[model samples]
Target: MKNFALFLVVCFLWSCNKDDQVETYTYTLGIPETMTKVEWRSQVAVQAPKPIASVGKIYAYQNYIFINEKHKGVHVIDNSDPTAPQVVSYINIPGNEDISIKNDFLYADNAIDLVVFDISNINLIHEVERLEDVFNYYSDYQMPAEVQAADYSNFDADSQVIVGWRVEERTEIVNYNESFFSDNSLATNTVGTGGSLARFQIVNDFLYTVGSFELKTFDISNLSQPNLVNTNTAGWNIETMFHADGFLYLGGSNGMFINSIANPAAPEYVSMFTHWDGCDPVVVDGDYAYLTLRGGNACGQELSTLEVIDISDKSNPTLVAQHALDSPYGLGFKGNDLFVCDGASGLKIYDKTNPLDLQLLHVFSDVQATDVIPLEDRLLMISDAALYQYNYDDQNNIVLLSTFNLN
Candidate 1:
């Protein structure tokens, strides 16, 4: 009888413990695809300056600065006074990704088309010409909700372009694992320099743009109308392009390729310096090429590093020095100072007078910087939420000139 009573007590305690435990469940919402591209060529209209949100590449020309608003448009900001910049106007171009200025013309990519705009008067910006169906293969838009997978079957290149995305909610259980993550020329009127993250660059009269696996060239000898000259096979996962002297440096996920642009219209491959798979952006100074490789997402690795390569001989480039970094993104140089955008670690400035031993000068930890442009008189740093301008002195001291927030 005593053994039976003890067994009953143990059973009762187990039942009580089971009842005390709470059950947890995850609920997900289904998001259906709703965004479609309209005929933006006919819908081009100048809107008043709106709030800045998704910022991409930035280009400065004369006293005006053009900031890309992701796929929406370009925001024109007058920075005549570095201390206080003003948003003069906004040019609405659907599916716009990058911008470059030469003389009075602004070149931008709109979905599959290369659109040229007359930016002589920021308020009166108008599309001068559209070269249709240039970039046909690009990543598609992804929905935010967790339930349904993106369906691109309806996306027809002949009639439509994936310009943007829209979200609609429905209650459903989504599989947790499946997730999809996805311009310009100028002349005699000098072409404005772009950030290291830029993929579109203008060399003399030819406009070069690097896609994932090809380099498309356009003869922009005529500013208003750009002609498609040729498309050459670049390499796998080409992320950015930098032009110097008579050569083109193509930064790919797998390697750095140097091409001789002796024939600006047809770039010939000279050499390739291979590296581990990662997203890389490169900038060249003198005989050295500096590349920052950060691994994450589609980059196929988890290593972050800054590599200094000796390109004294373009055909036989050699890696001279390397330094590990904390998720470095875009980098640029001014004089002997190199600025690296170290993702969440902010902006890291290094004195690269000695490329073998790059000395850390300063780290601005306030913002999550992604790219930088070291111009003649000031420094422009781009973060996820803001654009920062700073002035550097001989003592290596950097003073904040102004900040334009895109919240």
Candidate 2:
């Protein structure tokens, strides 16, 4: 009778313990892929054309189109003939996401370093100089939530570089009070034209860049030798920048910042215009700044809109109008035609003759547009899957010239 009572007591305790525990739930984590710092720094090559696996920013100089392959390198294409662009060469730049060209010199961000290349001979490009430790974007090394803490547990940052991620699903029991974790996946240039999504912009002799929340200036006054001249805290969550009439317009996650580049080498903050939190890329024409706030993906909020801000008074910018958009990404103006690469909703063309009431002209929903460059002769658009060229000469009937496979 004593043994039976002991067994019952043990069973009851076990039941209570199990009832108090939380159930298991499966979630995915991104495991970081790393390499030795030495190897990453020395890995720069210009070789035969390889298929582009990803798109970061698109830049056009003379007749060549340079497309960034996320954290890998850049794919150089001969766009002399927009009807059919060929992937002529690939510049192997580890952790490259932006590029700009001036006087045949191609400037790019290689990890935390600023690397300059002589691309005068498109087929024979070589590294000319490199400025080391100019950026503090360790955020690039930071993996998405939950997984990031795990990243610190497994990786050593002192001697390694994170180039990519390997996703893995895991199941773990959690208490009722424990919150669920989620992963957030985290140019210029030039004398050449950049898509509105470009962070690197070349204004005359100075090259300016916005990363995270800082503005970095590079004095490329000398075509061959570039110098890091200044660094200023410009805005919060800055995404892209535009230069117009000696002023720099910075688009951030929370607002628009205006800085006067009258000094060129160093920028002075002028004013700010706050907006809904989202990922925005800005472009300016005359006195108005056009911003496309995209909400989704890693961009905060679930609202997408096209906002026009009157910057005639740079110090006190106010909203002109806000129009709903499907998922606006990169945008630019070809004459008075405002072309927006609306994700999923395709190419949205508008008559911006009136900024207050942007007259919607067309929405080409056939393509999943992300970023675009309104070149002098044609329009170059990069989607999730391909590079598309269109002849916007006939505003009434914009024609697709060709589509290059980006897969």
Candidate 3:
């Protein structure tokens, strides 16, 4: 009886093992693409202001607010009355993300080209000039399961620029045993300040923009005609750029780089403060730099913290203090008060008069904040679905001004 029971147990184990060893297969999928050309230029026209559907970056110029519509265009709004801000015009720019204004001229990226527009007359805005192929990085597309297992030999880089993407269903066979991993500035004049999430900045007469691996410089000395002067290879995953004094502070996934813009057209590397890999945005005040590093998603690090670095000495930046945060994103400053958008935790206001002992003053926990731009007494906060404006009192109390919905 004991031998019969042992044989039955062995048979059961074999059957279970066989069931778990079923053959696995991989398949190729198709992905849809929106392609454009490097020479493509669109005439700036005044379209009936459309409701905000997507929010990318927000910029304030005088009483006007310019909000980016991701890869679409800029929505010009008259914010003279914060209580009743109205959308004035929509500047149709394809593959657009960032915008900066100087001396009535608006600078924005239209795919591979840097297109400048005359916003002095908002109703009759027109494209003045386009610097072709200044920006080379294109938006990535989703790869279908079928395309993932197939060759990208059909991708044509010569004539078309991929602007949008969608995945389609298809099939191909492949061995499923292996695992796969994928990884992925400006001006001066009366230029409006972008959020800490900005990649474009205008400092003096030069416009600086940081790409995934390079910093492209353009001479905005001639407002209508921006001349591409120099391109410097920055580190990988360069995310945001900020100008303080004569320095260009760059926040990358891996570190914070300080470049001297003493020569506005030619930036020289000053120093770099390294940290764990993550998506980061930086803002500076006085002698200290506030950097927020967030984890999860494609950022690659599991850390969520705010780092304060002393930059009195530009050549060497030292980490002065560190504070653990909850998924912090873009940040900005109003005087000594630091406004941090802590994702789901909402907007956190910190008094950084003393960088070493940072104090939290307030937090609007109800809002899902991602980035902030503090303009004078008003604060502009961007979430996934809305653009919010606020007015702060002398005692640091915030008053809700208005909200523009982006569904």
In the order shown, what is each candidate's alpha-carbon RMSD?
Answer: 13.6, 10.2, 11.4
Least accurate 10 contiguous residues by lDDT in model 2? 2-11
lDDT of 1 at 267: 90
Task: Summarize candidate 3's per-residue lDDT along 92-146 as a digit string, tens digits.
Answer: 8877889989989999987678988888887888888988878765423222222
Clashing pairs in 1: none
Candidate 3 weakest lDDT stretch, 10 residues: 2-11
Task: Report the C-alpha lDDT of model 1 over 86-136, residue by residue, as the tens digit.
Answer: 888888877677787888898988756788999887778888998987885
Best by lDDT: 2
Model 1 is weakest, by summed lDDT over 10 consecutive residues, at: 2-11
- Model 2, 386: alpha-carbon shift in Å? 1.5
341 Cα displacement, candidate 2 (Å): 0.9
Cα error, residue 2 of model 1, in Å, equals 80
lDDT by residue for model 2 (321-361), tens: 99999788999997799999899999999999988889999
Each model's TM-score, in the order given?
Answer: 0.80, 0.83, 0.83
Q: Which stretches of candidate 3 lie over 4 Å from their true place?
A: 1-40, 43-45, 139-152, 166-198
